[model samples]
Target: MLEEEYQPRRELPPHLRKAPAPEAPFSYELRDAVLADMPAVREIYNYYVANSTVTFDEDRKSLREWKSKFTYLQKLGMPFIVAEAPSGQLLGYALVSPWKQKRAYRFTVENSIYLGPAATGKGLGRVLLGELIDRSKAAGLKEMIAVIADQGAESSVALHEKFGFTEVGRMGRVGYKFERWLGTVMLQRSLK
Candidate 1:
């Protein structure tokens, strides 16, 4: 568990670009995910699936299937965790998985984080990600990658950068969503 600490960044996304102050983050819990958390975890991810191309998951998973997904991550020894409010409401979830299926790519993992729609902009992403990076390092992972969906996906890309992730690649117009073509940005952070 991490105690409250704040470090404001100079660059912020357009929506939050000119805000005069940072919001106080709520007290939250971060812990490894159990099978029972799939429902709430899926609920958090479902919003992005329906509204944005942040995730390419066109079809959402049922609890049974989601459990399988979690099981697979466990088999790979990847970390899957959630952030929750003091009242036990899930605020967000994050995990690291194989960056690629090949054996040579084993040392690198792709990271994903989804804050509850109402929970965005609270600086909790940094808190969860800070811990995520720590855990990955402890697990002996060498690198972590983030394949963010679009140039406009600045908040997430910036979050990664804040945690020492650097932009490694960009492929334009790689995905079609909401009747528009979107670009993909790849960012990397070393765990060593």
Candidate 2:
């Protein structure tokens, strides 16, 4: 055996390598978000904002804005969960927020979920959303909503269907991005 061939490999540079998407068994536990989770949460959320229609914003959010979001969730007593691997890394996050600002809209909320690049298509998203629904119902919310970008074209819609959400409305050319307009679809799942 050549001595040089026995050495362990070091981390490869981005251009020369690929990383595996994180996956675990279909089951994952959810916990309340904590201050310590801000960095990982910011990283995962910004990744989607930068690379996909899962989030519509063109610009990544600052840490201060992240903190403000966290504060809003806290004030609403909404569930903000960080899904974790058995080894304890933050795999993804799911959250619920006020569907509309009016007092009449207080009983409804919108849910959002995002996974790290390496964590997609592994069934983790479904688990996080299921948990979020349970939390919303427990909080006495009447309906859970999903507003999906037309270009999203992924499980964001399918997952909602699996949970019994029905398409309630659609808007044509409601969003402009990437030099074009995109439609929007809204789905709602009744909790009562």
Candidate 3:
């Protein structure tokens, strides 16, 4: 949970404010997330929660809370993967979790992807998501959905489009963050 004085979603500290300048291609590997990667995972997620409307949650979660969520995903056998640079930096992560808990919804999943603030615009998202799609299919998932919280996230939307996801729905003014009414766009693709 965030303190009462937490920064508004629209206003972030300099480091978390914008995508860093793009860097030359670097060595990176896509692999299954380990129990030790939760801190890096939390760091990336908390940035979005605290600094942008990419996520609707306004409060940063504690490490314990995140580990609990991590464990739950593991229990469900959902995919959780991380992007690690050769230098040992955890650049980003992508995962799939249940879209809903109903028995009838077991074959569907919601996707979440996040990159380190400095790691944006470097094309890691494409790599992570491609691998995620392969793994999801291998796990026998029938559909994958992305609930994008910001309509202005062009890159994310474009990435999904490039991978065959189509805009299935939008809920305008459905979320209030940073003292403004925000919207959510949902995109989906079939795994089969």
Candidate 4:
């Protein structure tokens, strides 16, 4: 065998090395969602549905579906809110819908909070959830439930717990998504 020649590894020059990205200024205002906001809301939700197990939905939701939901929530006097940037771009959304269709379950609702990819890890979720809870209380809702996916949703579970939501139950392997079994952790909080 021929003898190998020695080679020296070269390091990139300081200016050539990649620098950390500068954080952009993030400011948003929370307000009640309007009919025009469904498209943006659908895009945000579809991102999770198509890419992560955080949502168990295997198919993307249509704009019509989102609009229908908005109408239903509006008719029920439920809280459906969005966070918008100064530039009028939607940052995220949070809502509470009836937990069950029965008349006896009218006082209870299930809460859902979804943030844009760029909006996570900046305490936006905390702000959104805080406002959601306050609005729910103002709407005379008595209880709020959170059904969180056990996989790829640890942050969601933690966020809910931080807001005084207690784990009421857990179901294992009850959902099949992404070619794998998934489970859910149910948490509940009293708005009263």
Number of the candidate with higher TM-score, 1 or 4 = 4
The better candidate by lDDT, 2 or 4, is 4
On TM-score, the leading prediction is 4
Candidates in order, TM-scores: namely: 0.84, 0.83, 0.86, 0.89
Cα lDDT, model 2, residue 15: 85
Q: Which residue pairs overlap in candidate 3's backbone?
A: none
Candidates in descending lDDT order: 4, 3, 1, 2
For residues 81-144, what per-residue lDDT tens digits would candidate 3 score against the true structure?
Answer: 9999889999999999999999999999999999999888888999889999999999999999
Cα displacement (Å) at residue 112, model 4: 0.6
Computed on alpha carbons, the lDDT of every model, listed in order, comes to 0.87, 0.85, 0.91, 0.95
- Which 10 consecutive residues of model 2 have the lowest summed lDDT? 20-29
Query: Which candidate number would show the highest lDDT if scored against the true structure?
Result: 4
lDDT tens per residue, model 2, 56-169? 788988888888889988888888999877777789999999998999999999998989777788888888899899988898888998999977665788889999999999
TM-score of candidate 2 to 2 decimals: 0.83
Candidate 1 structure quality by residue, lDDT tens digits, 71-102: 99999888898998888889998899999999
Stretches off by above 4 angstroms in model 3 are: 1-24
Residue 54's lDDT within candidate 4 is: 85
Better of 1 and 3 by TM-score: 3
Error of 1 at 53 (Å): 2.0
Better of 2 and 3 by lDDT: 3
